[model samples]
Target: MLKRKISDYLESYFTPNRREALLITGARQVGKSYAIREFGKSHYSSFIEINLLEDSIARTSISKASNSKDLLLRITAIASQPLIKGKTLIFFDEVQVVPEIVTAIKFLVEEGSYQYVLSGSLLGIGLKRISSMPVGYLTVKEMYPLNLEEFYRACGISDNIFSVLEEAFKAEREIDSIIHRKLMELFRLYLIVGGMPAVVQTYLDTNDIKKVVNKQREILSMYVEDISQYDINNKLYIKDIFNLIPAELNNPNKRFILKNLNENTKFSRLENSFIWIREAGVAIGVYNIEEPKLPLELAKLRNLFKLFSNDVGLLACQYADGIQLRILNNDIDINYGSIYENAVAEELYSHGLKLYYFNSKKQGELDFVIKLDDKILPIEVKSGKNYLRHNALKNVIENKDYEIEKAYVLYNENIKRVGNIVYLPIYLMMFIKNREIENLIWKIDLSSLPQ
Candidate 1:
């Protein structure tokens, strides 16, 4: 698949004048190595890849080297390639295996002379362990599962998909019915396949359900392995937390509760385990955002929060054989609500926002609290048109001063605005970023807006 966007980000770091050491961070098997390699091939004349975990000699060489320059020489010798100045790219894969190697990259970028990319699966864990080092020494690039645009490219759809969407966004017109249908089809597939690189690529080449299942299973298996490597002491607790997500998403509250696992289980008992899961990039905690502003942290819920897995594809697999059918709104509507919320959670997670939710002591619950620009936007997720009764949304609108820019409800239809509330189709949600839905909000004129 063409991951041009991520490559574009990497390009800025490698641009000769804008030289910086790159730290490619993501959950395991999200294609960090493949992306770094692709960038090197396209941008550099000679590329050298160092597998720090697989090669003992290279590890020893790096450790034994007296200084950063000596280490560079040893890496070049092991790669059997000349590390030319400016024209060569050096990739340090699995650099987290040796935390000190990250320190070395900072030295090489500032003191020595080389274009470098460093990547690791347990990158978050390593960073926490190595926190005393300089912070701004390297630029960080996050690689997520292939987003919708990338998924479209990987699926071999004509570039027309993006071009048409861009045109519609620019021209401010309704998309042709055929194009909308096609976009929806690709979107449904994305909901099922998710943006994981291996899963997307598997669907691209084979289009086989079995193959897709195997890839998801493989990625999950690798995560299981990571729990052991990264959290061996609390491995059992971590496994329990991981296994409980599919069940917890089924709950109406969605905020994780240890009691939901066992009536007696306590938060303090699983706090470290949950933190480990977040650090591993396998699951993330969405805190409550009470207001919108520069630092969204001021409005966080200390006790209640929701947890989302890194990829929706794995979450789908954990549920059933034909889970996509649930979206049609059958007798399984309750579970479908959980899945829809999870899907929305995945989209929000992709944007790298500080997520929180809104709720007053006597007021009801809203699905999400997201900050866009200077506005703190309250978002509510509805599985069907029936739930858009706007009880929760109306509560937040009338009672709270809340920066109160505007409110959003993600449901199953075209965009509509009633009073200060805007209703958006769940599919268009993938495009919402920085908490500003203005681009999406404008898609529907507020006058003939839904009530």
Candidate 2:
């Protein structure tokens, strides 16, 4: 069985002490249900599963329940397994089909009969459509395609190796040359097979390229079907944009041009189309930042951005057949820049960073910049031998106006520190994660104010 980091996440999140409803959401085929099922079976005395998409009777019975108690009654009537109070996990899968269930979740949580969990393919869009959102009663965690670290574990790389890599990154030391070459090979394979559970499984099971490509295509088709089924009003624009992502990323600058979809169209006219694909969790949009500074959102130029397929495997599948083979052979003839950028994007996005890149006519462009530990770290993604030649990155760092102390260049190289730049292997992005949590308690000077 393929391992996932989210499995551990589910355990840590739903301890016996914390009573809360949970929602596991991501793009279709990212393995949300499988993770939930495994967690439920292992942790609970009884696991009750309700899949609305496959069970018409269950969908019909529970879709329109009048209240929390009535909903519970309807749920219990069609449950596939026993529901033991305080020891059961009632998983509502494919909940996008019956989103009103979210409206009634607050009352259900208050009732506190069984631990509740929900999952769906397009919860980002479906949850927004709910008339009443259970604001404080529910917790949400988004699942993503497996990152390099999780993929490493699945491939049987030991935990000790991970610790060594972490230590190497922290100390800015080069990995052993032999180990680095082996890892580089593995990382390229990861680009081709990707972290989608099904695709990864196909690779591990048969080690066949044709099977992996076929699986990725099936998923891409399913995404198109999801668009047609869910957003009938704007499926045309959405599909056109979705279909164009591969070609668009291959462009020189890799910034998606709205005109590419339709010569006469403007971003204002086609804004919802972009939003639909993003909300569906089928694509990642990395916005262009006007200035690299704190609060990257404020500097964000929404109209200017790069759109990437949510999974690199799907992106590769969208391309002509030989790209994967080329990637594996380490052929530098094709422009691997877009592939590298997309990999970096998926990694950064999965780790909860808002994707931003700086582009200035005077200063050139930094591939990505993110706020980490309360400061912006400029990033450059290089896939060629000329990894050290980054005029844009150099300009950004030297500009005293920005006061940016450090930056990172993710390349096919070992860890090194030269001046303010930290060069790392691209896979180390699995280690660059959430901003450090701050002390939320802000006690005021009450004595000075009142005395």
Question: Per-prediction TM-score, please?
Answer: 0.89, 0.96
Query: lDDT per residue, candidate 1, 1-451, as tens digits?
Result: 5565678778766778555678888898878899889889888888999888998888878878777778877887898577777788888888788778777666677754668888988677778777455467777767777766667777777766667665554344456677676666666677668778878878888887678877898888888888888777999888888988888887767778777666887777777778888877888788765544446687676656788888878888788776755532244343456667777776777777667766656677778877776676778887754855767677667755554767877765555567787766566665667534555443646897668
Query: Residue 430's C-alpha lDDT in candidate 1?
Result: 57
- Candidate closest to the true structure, highest lDDT: 2
The local distance difference test score of each candidate is: 0.74, 0.89
Off by over 4 Å in 1: 156-160, 163-174, 262-265, 289-295, 324-334, 435-451
Residue 140's C-alpha lDDT in candidate 1?
71
Q: What's the C-alpha lDDT at position 28 in model 1?
A: 87
Q: Write the per-residue lDDT of candidate 2 for residues 1-451, one digit (tens) a residue.
A: 8788888888888877566889888999999999999989999999999999999999999977888888899888898777888898889999999998877778988898888899998788888889988988889889999888878788888988899888998888999888888888999998888889999999989999889999999998999999999999999999999999999999989999877889998789898889889978999998999899888899998899999889988888889978889999999788888888888899889888888888899999888999987888999999988988999999989888788999999999889999999999988887887656888988777676655
Tell me how far the alpha carbon of residue 333 in candidate 1 is from the true structure, in angstroms, after superposition.
5.1
- Error in Å for residue 292 of model 2: 0.6
After superposition on all CA atoms, how large is the RMSD of candidate 2? 1.8
Compared to the true structure, candidate 1 yields what TM-score?
A: 0.89
